[model samples]
Target: MVNINEIARLAGVSRTTVSRALNQSGYVSEKARKKITKVIEETGYVPSEQAKSLRLQRTKVIGVVLPKISTETLGRIVEGIDEILSASGYQILLANSSLNKEKEIAQLKLLESRRVDGIILAATNREETLMQTIRELRVPLIAVGQDLPEVSSVIYDDFNAAKTIMKKMISKGYRRIGFIGVEETDQAVGQFRKQAYLDVMNEENIEIQEGWMQQADFNIQSGEASMEAMLQVCSTRPEAVFAVTDRLAVGAMQTIRKRGLRVPEEIGIAGIGASEISRYVTPPLTTIDYQYEEAGRESARLLLEQLESGKKSVKKSVMNYGLLERDSLI
Candidate 1:
């Protein structure tokens, strides 16, 4: 392992200059900084993060808590976060909740105890206990995909996206539209999005079916079960179905095919998230792109800004969504 003295000798700079450039502490001329950077890069001499943290009183590590790491949406968001944070000399400490809501709460405290500079929660729901914990937190926390009072968030326009999707379904002359949703405790995907669908149905005077609304967890298997249950409940089935997520929508498609029904022709289907598999599905899935990755990048920026500037200002940024028209819906 190359030491700071070797780096300084290679760069023809003093040890203090090398220290300032590596630790981002004190000032160094651009020329000296470039030389120091080149030497560090060529020698692959990485400063000890532990010692740096000790001197700066900062870990330079951001904690990220996610409900699950396997989803395309969550993965993309984390990718975006890493794109920005990694370039800025920060590392991510991940905590997976494994689809357990209580674990999400527990991970927050764990990250705090570890003294991570900031935390970004890619959450499913905004529960009361989670909100209370966030409110009491001294460390900066940004909630992604869920809304909580007095907390900084990078949330989607789920309500409007739902409204728009329902409008499209109505315009396509699909009166009876089934909804595959999650637990209402998940305010964004489960409640806000579902409410918008209901409201739009009401506006268009399209009466929803008693068994058309099905609840499922955020997984493909649960979605398949929910669809089967929904069909069993309805004497006359819906002409179309709108699932809260692409994974769920794909699962519904699987069930539809197993039952000898063709998608979009027999039963139109749509979903949100615009997952990578959405386009490759048999008929392709018409879904909403929530720009989740951009949300992650924005959240990282928000957390870093406050951490670097030592400013405590609450910021709630609602990101935009786009309709992805594909063979499934049209």
Candidate 2:
């Protein structure tokens, strides 16, 4: 593609003069305009719509970065975002990081290069490099799932949600409870949720066995492996388990059933993220509903406010959650 720089070089004029000649919005000498026109005619250089939008400083597009694209939770969130953004005549440009920290930062920079009106990131980890990159963005940005410093965020009450579920589990007279979580780099799902479980267990005066707490990745296979490792290493088996995500919980259930254990009878299990498949499992899974769609809508709404008002204002929205009591944790 013949860009304005090439056009400028061919025309013996600056890029700014070429832009001025193309848009006719600024003063351009007749000699320079003729030179640019001759270059355009020779090279067949028609300016792209993206170039025009960049000149005008309005693309009417929002960049959305996700940790993974296949999850139902993220799908619902995108649905909500599209619901609001489409009404405002803005389109979404989606980029998936696939849960890689480096890829997350790279995608953010790529979106910025695209010159989208704004960006909404469903962030996983709050690493310093990622946070610094967010701080340096030239466009308005909103973060989902993690509370980033000085940045507008839409987050779930992860600590309270986990604590509430744990308290309920304790109320059922289950002292030997296990936990499956991700790395603490992810502030919402990993650190806050794990801390809530620890607090609840400490408050109830329950002893957490050495192998009772295990870390796993976001996938079901990792959940199964983590659970199996827990069972192998622990001298005393836990009566129940709390997984940080529904997929992980489902994986744990698979491992338990494979060992001829009955759910909620031999081993009770629950997870966060109220995924659709959680309901249809042989024994329904109990999980927390984080209102994923609502988070998306709210984040979009805030970004629109910044765009419309031409102001970058910092705001924090803590989304509500609910515990769905089901057969798994009965």
lDDT of every model, 2 decimals:
0.86, 0.90
- Model 1 scores a TM of 0.84
On residues 168-269, what C-alpha lDDT tens digit does candidate 1 reach at each position? 899999998999999998889889889988998899888787899999998899889988988889988989999989999999999998889889899999
**Model 2 RMSD in angstroms:** 5.7
Scored against the true structure, residue 231 in model 2 reaches a CA lDDT of 93
Q: How many backbone clashes does candidate 1 have?
A: 0
- lDDT tens per residue, model 2, 1-330: 889899999989999988876754466776886777777766768645534443345768899999999999999999999999999889999999999999999999999887688999998988899999998999999999999988899999999999988988988888999999999999999999999999999998888989999999999999999999989999999999999999999999999999889898999999999999899997999989998999999999999999888889999999998989999976
lDDT of model number 2: 0.90
The local lDDT score (0 to 100) that residue 54 gets in candidate 2 is: 33
Error of 1 at 153 (Å): 0.7
What is the Å distance of residue 330 in model 2 from its true position? 2.7
Superposed model 1: Cα runs more than 4 Å off: 1-52
Residue 193 lDDT in candidate 1: 86
